[model samples]
Target chain A: MSPSPEQAAFPEAFAAALREPRSAIPARLAARPGVDPAVRFAIYRNNMAAGLGRVLADRFPVLRRLLGADFFAALTDAFIRQHPPAGPVLLEYGALFPNFVERFPPSQHLAYLADVARLEWLRHCALLAADAAPIDRAALAAQPPDVMARLRFTLHPSLAILRSPFPIVSIWRANIDPANPAVVPAGLPGENALLVRPGLVAEIHAVPASRADFVERLQAGVALGDATNLVGADLTAALAFLLSAGILTGFFPVSDDAARRSDPA
Target chain B: MAPRRIPSLSTSAVPASRPTPAGLSPPAGVGLRPPHFRAALAEPGAVDFLEVHPENYLCDGGPQHHFLTALRQDLPLSFHGVGLSLGGADRPDRRHLARLRQLVDRYQPFHFSEHLAWSSHGGTYFNDLLPLPYTQANLARMSAHVAETQDCLGRQILIENPSLYLTFAESEMSEAEFLAELSRRSGCRLLLDINNLYVSAINAGWDSWAMLAEFPQDAVAQIHLAGHDHCRDADGGSLLIDTHGMPVADPVWDLFAAIAPRLAGVPVLIEWDQDLPDWPRLVSEASLARQLAGNALAEARHVAIA
Candidate 1:
């Protein structure tokens, strides 16, 4: 339905007030005798900026801490103006914040900030993601030898593989937990983080390049043998890590179904 | 007050299937925040019941879900919603309604409530409960949306009057009249927020007590008390902001005291969303509300006997 002129004007004026610092209150709004429309409008503007800023801070605490309060507040204000939340769920509100940081001019010097933000977002996602029952080792052990090669594993719903060019995992851990203050030694390379929520607690594990590649391949729906082939010598260790971390939720035999339906060419 | 007539449609349409007495009793509670979850779970009966914003607990799994599940087993839950946008141009979002339904089904909360304001427009949702023009078109839209929300949840939901900073020139009806008509049309109840009434009264230059007298007391299913920030307008007059960051202001408490007796057996919630106090502090506020409610009930009984 088309909006009533009042309905149409109310949100438009309110939204403009929220976005622009100096926007006049729409003509339709009546100011109390003593109150200026600008003063009244500022309350809403402050609420929009501060509310979204809080959401960003809650999701990206380490980043906020690193940037300090004022800088973080200004950055979130700019981000909120650009992208007010698309929906009511604050849990998923800051998906683009890390990307915004990547292109944000003032923060360019801090090369690792975006990656750290990505790690934080991943952790946030892992925390709220659905719970999944881990695959039992005995169930996997019961699979026939011929079926093993064709098995395509389903990772836990909360599992996330994040690869960053900076030593983001250490930075994230150090910044988030004061006890484990990250001391970045010189000449350290990039890191890959494996995020998982086996139970209610979310955990982040650092993985080597080979294991990261293997996990990425598995995430891309590669079968067991194919994924293992991509990792070469790291296959055994990666599989052990996956199983131990309760990352694999279930698996299905892909080639076995085709093999049973027709003779191998 | 001659036992203000319960709207006949409300009595006939709303089901009496709710199993717990939580829906029927006047228990003072506080908004359940994450910081106080441990204290809340440890002593569920510390207050009469607990109110939580369903949007905060919409996630599939987390410590939030875990503790809330445990808390539900003890105290009755009130799924007060902040995101339904009932007065928006469009009907309530189907996806959000479904999520609310899932929560209602799981928790069986004794009360479900949403604001009378709109928060979303076109696709973007402003985090705040944005204001609405009380025009006939807007009223029709809001009433239909409330009914739809009630139908979706399969229970009567409470519509909260928003704390307004500015009034629209096109508003055709007073907030009380709009809310009363909405309750009549949609078979929904009211969540009369005392803080909001006080703030909006001051901000809009209306008499707070007179506004309370006009409010549909019989339809009030719950009451919300919160603290607001006092600011100075351009002309140096007092401007009240519903910050929900402090203790209930004295005037608001007075209004609650006056209104409490009229709306007997309605749950009162102390809402402190920002600068949240310690668990004991919030519990103390709830205890105060309980005392006030108890006194009001007694006075109401005394008047009835006399």
Candidate 2:
């Protein structure tokens, strides 16, 4: 016979105690009569605390490096206790960590840390993202002008945009790349990043703030003409960079009626 | 959330035909890590086969898959899962089952294995493998879950004996008996981890070799050899922790040497997951495993193998 819901409570209690240090070892777990469960139970505790700390550390190398080991470990303990992994694919773990860092009291002083973490997470995602085919320029050219205006793009699976009030691009570069000794400037100039993996490696481009509006609109699946109109300055370079970067997977023209349905009234 | 449906990379990634290399008899396998991708490809015959944790390759497509696609053309592959909590009180996650099945169908590896221990409960996956009590009810739960996994995978998977730290008072049967019955009931095979048996037996105060003598060897389909760490318990008593971070300790190697005769022709994997050495060093460990296993098979047949 399988465990009854009452019996099933045993593992539930065990898992609960694994997360909470204060809880006594599930009363049923045993060693020999003289042996204490504390020593054995500590292995599972360390596995969750230290094991998960390593996972989070691996995911955010730049953040870990920036905060130093002691601080990272301190923050990571709080992070793991609150956000243990929901599934087995560890690659997908730590998605909410950036937001956690944003609210985390200790990291609040390092205002740029969250965005840098966000950037690293994107790079992590890009490392394992699916292969995709970019839009065919020749095929796109054959479409009518009116149809092209209302067209929306299907971005690559790995594409992500991060806009921050701090110079995250320079911070990420200075810390991560060994050869690139480019020092971060003193003034906190806001930066926007365009991230997409062209092949095996994901590339980060620091985009002009003026074009941030255009990128945001397009990402929201806004029509091409409308997205273009949102930006005042010339977008020739930005458009070229995006088109050449393998960011757009495909494109489709949305009818006015369909567009309205997608948007809120 | 629904598991995203992505295009299958198998048809696109893998080559139509893979070349088989002639090698020394009875292969030794090594866990393929990112650090050794280039070396594995550069010298295909260095190790006879490669094993990977399927969870690491769960993504859609990338360099790891890129290299594996190329390496598959040169050597055989095995998928050892670390996440399918078959010993959990609850049923296996259908989404995890589906995703794992997708890889199994794509790779078509000869050996697939998971631990008898449960690593997830109440929807949260503990990164480390956790112990399962060996009660009749727990045994029934594990058997059903294993059957469900096999039915979904459409292939036989091996269950490994986890390295454990403590015994459960709730357990009504011995771990060996539980594993034997699990295989008998689930119609699955075993992937015996020699290091795990050594570590667990010592930690639980049982004689390691005596437990090995009682173990059900006929059910084994694969073998794993790894290292453990020795530490003092709170009471200052000796404790063995299965870290898989160190080189195969002398005792484990001795255990493997002793048991290799019983497991002739089985693929042996050297699993060093942490503090990885250079590729050449890891391959040497694989070579040693191959030599020990090969020598055993040779003696059994009374024929020398080069």
Candidate 3:
């Protein structure tokens, strides 16, 4: 038999009920003589909130630790209700969580907390970002002098750089590192992070403020010589660090890249 | 006492299954989580097969994709998806299906399966298997979504029965009847989650054996043996949550023993998602399932001969 016409909107009604704790349960759910329908319906509520909260907690442990379990749970619940996941890949979920915390009033006192969440989020993304083989110095040496000069080098897909007003790297390191938990020096102008997943492991290196722009520009598809000249800082150390860390994927001539982009096909 | 046959919606049109790996025989598998990756890699023969939630490996490339690539070389795979939202009114997401197709093409998994319940509503993915009323409209919608998913993957996908906390009063048929008709209409197979069967039976007040008897037994292709937790719901009434945290409880094992005779060559996965045990402990649990299936199948054969 067909369902009741009213039940046509069942999923929508059910979702609304689950999203709002104060909303009454849908009318049609029934249990046997002994079972309580309200209690049974709550299973969905608890599971939805608890499971999503667990994902947030797992992804942002420092946020959890910093906010403490209770406060983190409250914040997660608020975030979950306001901004539920838009996609099935949960790893892609909560991209806005860092932004959410930044705007959250309770966490306003912890200025670096939002940056830490951003760092953690980047680290999480790095761990799962698409794998790409980086060209070693040998591969670079194979390129001719002209290609090397105007090389529009492709960086590793996992590479990300974040600069924050507060010392996010020191704070993150202090929270995650147990062996050498260094005291986070407060009131610093900022600290920069260079994230790369060279292999399966994701590494977060502290980048100098002066060189962060150069690496970001390179990541944004700027050619090597132009990016270096644009920054016009002591970029030798940053370039050396990128090479040593295997962040350079491959490179082609700038003019060749421009020609390909200009082609309609 | 048999399930009602939908003669109009017979599975005659269903495509034949692809050739499965040799490991499918004597099949007992374990869910390979990240914690056991090293151990699972080191010893490929710990189980005949390995099952994983395809949602976890939907990303382009990672150590997980690498590990699955390596592991697939030695053992067969069962890709159980958790996010398809097959029972939803909306069509299955084409992008998710495309990614799944890529994985299927890349790995050539022996079996691909999703649940009968929906997990997405509107745009938000709830991330939990949510139930539906057992009505013909829901059934038709589910069948269409299942067919779309199977067509997209270019393979027959099994639909698993979800453990429900409460039954819908608006239902027009039994869960078994709903699933039977769904399979008949969609030409899909069934992944009989034995633990879910036991949990739903007790919570919804049914004789577990009677409930099991009502299932479309012939369509059953795979089995899931998992653990659950017993707790009081808000009303302080007994409730069994499908937590998959601990080892398989005795009652669920009893249910498995009863059904194993029907699952001769089917791969049974020991699913422990929460409170994860070490690799050795997981191996031991899988070994127990293998042992139980073996003994049960042997007894069934002996009884038939007698």
Q: List RMSD in Å for every model shown.
A: 4.7, 6.5, 5.1
Give the clashing residue pairs of candidate 3, or none.
none
Worst 10 residues of 3 chain B by lDDT: B9-18
Off by over 4 Å in 1: A1-8, A138-152, A178-186, A221-226, A230-236, A251-265, B1-25, B303-306
Q: For all candidates, state DockQ relative to the true structure.
A: 0.62, 0.60, 0.61
Query: What level of docking quality does candidate 2 show?
Result: medium
lDDT of 2 by residue, B154-261 (tens): 978899999988888777887789999999999999988999998887788878888787788889877899988998776667789888888898888878877777
Q: How accurate is candidate 1 locally (lDDT)?
A: 0.82
Error of 1 at B34 (Å): 2.0
lDDT by residue (B1-306, candidate 1, tens digit) is 544333232212211212232222256788999889898888776787788999987898878888898987777778889998898876789998998899888888878999989888778888898887888888888999999999999999999999989888899999999999999999999999999999999999999999999998878888999999999887888899898999999998899888877776567899998999998899899878767766765676778899
The per-residue C-alpha lDDT of model 2 at residue B267 equals: 72
Candidate 2 Cα deviation (angstroms), residue B163:
0.3
Pick the winner on lDDT between candidates 1 and 3.
1
Chain B TM-scores across candidates: 0.91, 0.89, 0.90
Interface RMSD of each: 1.5, 1.8, 1.7
Worst 10 residues of 1 chain A by lDDT: A256-265
Of models 2 and 3, which has the larger lDDT? 3
If ranked by DockQ, best first, what sequence of candidates would result? 1, 3, 2
Model 3 Cα lDDT, one tens digit per residue, B1-306: 222232232222111222333222246789989888889999987787888888888786778888988887777788899999998878999998999899888777778989989999888898899988888889988999999998999999999999988788878999999999999999999999989998888788777888888989899978898999998755565689999999999988998888877756667889999989999899899888877776776777678889
The numbered model that scores best in TM-score is 3
